[model samples]
Target: MLDKNVNLEGKNILVTGAAGFIGSNLVLELLKTLKSVNIVGIDSVNDYYDVKIKEWRLEELEKEAKTHKDSTWKFVKGNIADRGLIDSIFAKFKPAVVVNLAAQAGVRYSIINPDAYIEANIIGFYNILEACRHSYDNGEKGVEHLVYASSSSVYGTNKKVPYSTDDKVDNPVSLYAATKKSNELMAHAYSKLYNIPSTGLRFFTVYGPAGRPDMAYFGFTNKLIKGENIQIFNYGNCKRDFTYVDDIVEGIKHVMQSAPARKNGEDGLPIPPYAVYNIGNSNPENLLDFVTILQEELVRAEVLPRDYDFELHKKLVPMQQGDVPVTYADTTALERNFGFKPSTDLRTGLRKFAEWYKEFYKV
Candidate 1:
């Protein structure tokens, strides 16, 4: 395993999308793990799903912060797309590690709201790159590592069993996928030009308690709770590498400590200092089976009645416009470099979600 180069303890770290599912979890993990660390978070807290959920996450962070007396937490309510605000935060915080997780996330939503994708995914990311590039001014130690979120959607509909980082991702099937692909390209350019050590993580279908409501597992739960039919896309043939939120956060924490080493090639210039990796379970679960597990978990958690008619609430439907058949991740490189891989099984992960949902919704 590659040796860790950046130590997170006693450092100022900036995490965008602070109120988000993955972001909030990451922040909590950092506070719990590191002593004497300062974290600055930024989020628009838009009403994309439920603002109350976002607020609840922030409240959790507040509670977590109280226990870690040596650590400091500051949150800014704003958008990363706002250049002035982003620049000001970077200038003030001067974070040693920057994690960018703010973006328009849904594939289907991107179909109708392409502008949000471009504005947040494209322009917002560009602003981040610019800020990172400028952070090294006056021979100051700038961002040691820049880690951002990418999606498995970048693979499109490749027939390959397991997607690899070395595989071609030039063909993106959805606008959301295209934007994520664009983020990889933009980061690569900044890394090459400014010698920023940047890493992009291609996450599979990430789900858990307090997750994004637009995701299949969460959405299906909501619809089933209300007695509405939940559509099983691709006629129940679709498969996904459903990764748990805690596993994803663990991978991120590992990556944050180890940035790509900066070195000069034969040309006497920087070697881009860039890398990308896939963080997934490497085990794909069929949609129908996934739904069945989710249903059983809900019943076990008392979120749904044991006698609820699940058959009446599930509908098999054709593939949506911006969806792929399957997504499997090849995590060989991740394990080789970090000695870590996501191992959370569907039943275990779904059980946590069901329990959390039961408590959160007062079922």
Candidate 2:
């Protein structure tokens, strides 16, 4: 409960992965809401999904930057795993708040390439922690808050209905999940040792317009438009807490304003100022139901014809390796603390994605 507050006005904020889906949306909101703020964004611009979507997000950020009278935006194309690059950025910006959203993102991809997860999610996050540590040199009040992304996948194969922060996340089913859990552990250590006020957000299934094309909703739309069959894993029996990207961004924005307070133990050592919360839609939707809504939305947006044979184009298959049957988040902690919960329904989120897909692809 380190009670630290950041004034976005006249402050420098650094957002890693700023060109990514949630990062870009966050930048736009900051530029729109706060005045006299300087935002520095860095991303590797990797072709994990489509570089075009990242570029499009950056384009939208630039548009918002131009319209703001007092807010400024800077984009640096680089990887967070590079210690020198991360250090240099911190040295130059001396940002009061650091949001580390950059990481190797997919579970299935991690199975194909486990090294990427270690390099980006683990090593990259280590570099971020190191930079935050050094930011406090010379008694400077550096990095009032260090907010980073965690994942609901950390609660691997839990029989629990609603995954909670209080649950033990020792079992990780994927390399990606392992790396994310490692991040929370590492952040806790850093917060304990260096007294870094840190918050880790475990995000559930995030989807929205201009979202990652690898996501099921976006990929389904793409495949359906091309008349290619879309595979529904686990015979379409899985459930997920499909949180809208905007809701995720909103949660991050609210969390950034407050940092854990440093408290001293009886021995006079500062207790670790660390916190973690689940940011997700409380309602879990079945995979088949989610796809059904996606199909309807696709037709409504004219991405698919009204008579499109969704059944014929959907292939029910066994669950892939490194995947869980469900991801239902308990957002009670986030709501209790931040007075906010993700309320965006799956249909509303998928509809926006469908509309964006049609417009972006000119389908």
Candidate 3:
């Protein structure tokens, strides 16, 4: 079980993108478990979605700080691509574990604004690596683990039902997927050369309260609220492994302790201290089924009327370019290693999201 109490006393943790959905949740859990462990959370808090939501997440951090005054929870509002800013943070806090979740996250948006992905996903990640490289004095307990967020989008139309880390990820259809794949590759090289134990987590369709509004579920909700037709891509035939945000955080918390290691090189020699895992719900749900449940939950939560017109309010559109047919994650390795898998039913997770959306939007 991932709920086991793990002590991270005295470990200074650094979380980038701490304003984002999964990042904010992970920060909360870390504060809850590790008593007074210093955390330096960095987020650019750009207008990726509504900046107000990011502000709300920062407010959560503020609340956490008030509760644990001695926890040393600090937030730095700046872009990670700024080398001077990142280096200064590294010199000041000297975090022991670095979680990189800051990235320009959006598949369709990437096609429109590819430069944003390059700056944030590539350049920003490079600055983080460099900062980590300089953190240690003669390699004495600098960074114990460097965990980063990858995406199932890297699967790129893989014929396999459940994609694994061992699967070939060379065919990234979108620039966003390419950047995530590039992050894994870059982490491998840095881990091999600098001995920075790094782990990459491939998150699949994370959703719940305080989730990304840009995702399909949230977008559907927005469209439904205005009595607009919701576009069902691929004629509502796609299936996805929609892992809840809390479950994703739990997986990350469990993985924080299980750091990667160098492989035994040439009969007891060491390979790069890098690994990747898919943190996803094993149960894949159809897109239409997910929407139906979401709509039902909205009605239950009173966000939508008991008899809101859903029949004529749906448009079956063709799949967008760079869109995959389905996204499924093979969690056999994740279960075997972490002894945990995301088990939240799509209804259960989406219901919570519907409730939150209703409240947040005051609909």
Candidate 4:
């Protein structure tokens, strides 16, 4: 098992996409765990879903920041793809640790707007790599670790049940998946070239309260509330390793502390200090079953009437483009290294989301 060696106390940490679901939750976790930590968060706060939710998350972060006497949180509104903005932020903060969570998310959206994916996931990630490289220009032991997000989509219709880090992931069906895979390649090159310790986490179907509204779980609820039928793609013959947001955050927190050790090759060259792991529940829940649980939770939370017609609100449809039938994560590497794995079940996670939805939307 890798040992946790990085000390976060009094250290400057930068989190891109800080107002987004994962980034905001991460900031809150850091404030709770570490004292005297300086957190710098940057986000474009785009209207990919509901901007209100992003603002709400930022509000929560601000509230949490105030509770910690020694810890301070600063929010910057900017795009990661803007090289000048990224450079300026790095120069000012001089963060020792960076968590890059900013990217144009969604599988279907990638088809509609491929440019957005390239600009944000490709160009944006390149800017981050360049910043990390330049941080060492002044002989400063800069950027102890760079942790970024990858996705389960990289598996790309694999026959394998449990998606493993060791599994071959060359086939990416969607532009979004391709970009995520590209990020891993880019990180590896930067790590090998600059000797930067970096890790990439392939998160699987992460959902929770205040999650991206584009996600199926949240979208379905909205459709049901509006008396519109929600599409169940692939004729409801799908399974997802639905990891809760908190569980994903826990995995990230542990990985941030345990970066790959820098090692030198016998040929007098630095071996790439890069690692990637899957952060998921490892339990694949059937789509129809998942919806059943979600509907029950929605009714239990009073977001829907007890007599709500679930069957009437669902439309089973053929498989969509760029979508796989199942996503089952092989988290052996995560468990072996971090001594942790996502354990939250589907019912429990969906219930929390239902309750949060009721309160947030005043349903």
User: Comparing 3 and 4 by TM-score, which wins?
Assistant: 4
Clash pairs, model 1 backbone: none
How does each model score on lDDT? 0.96, 0.91, 0.88, 0.94
Report the Cα lDDT for residue 293, model 3: 95
lDDT of 4 by residue, 85-146 (tens): 99998898999999999999999999999999999999999999999999998788889999
- The number of clashing residue pairs in each candidate reads 0, 5, 4, 0
**lDDT (10s digit) by residue, model 2, range 270-319:** 89999999998989999999898999988898888899988899899999
Better of 1 and 3 by lDDT: 1
Q: Which digits, one per residue and each the tens of the lDDT, describe model 3 over residues 121-177? A: 999999998887777767556777888999999999999878888899999999999
For model 2, the run of ten residues with the poorest summed lDDT: 1-10
Clashing pairs in 4: none
Displacement of residue 102 (Cα, Å) in model 4 is 0.3
Which portions of model 3 show Cα errors greater than 4 Å?
Answer: 1-7, 267-269
lDDT of 4: 0.94
Where model 1 places Cα greater than 4 Å from the true spot, the runs are none
Model 1 has a clash total of 0
Query: In candidate 4, which residue ranges exceed 4 Å CA deviation?
Result: none
Q: What TM-score do all the candidates reach, one by one?
A: 0.99, 0.98, 0.96, 0.99
lDDT of 1 at 178: 98
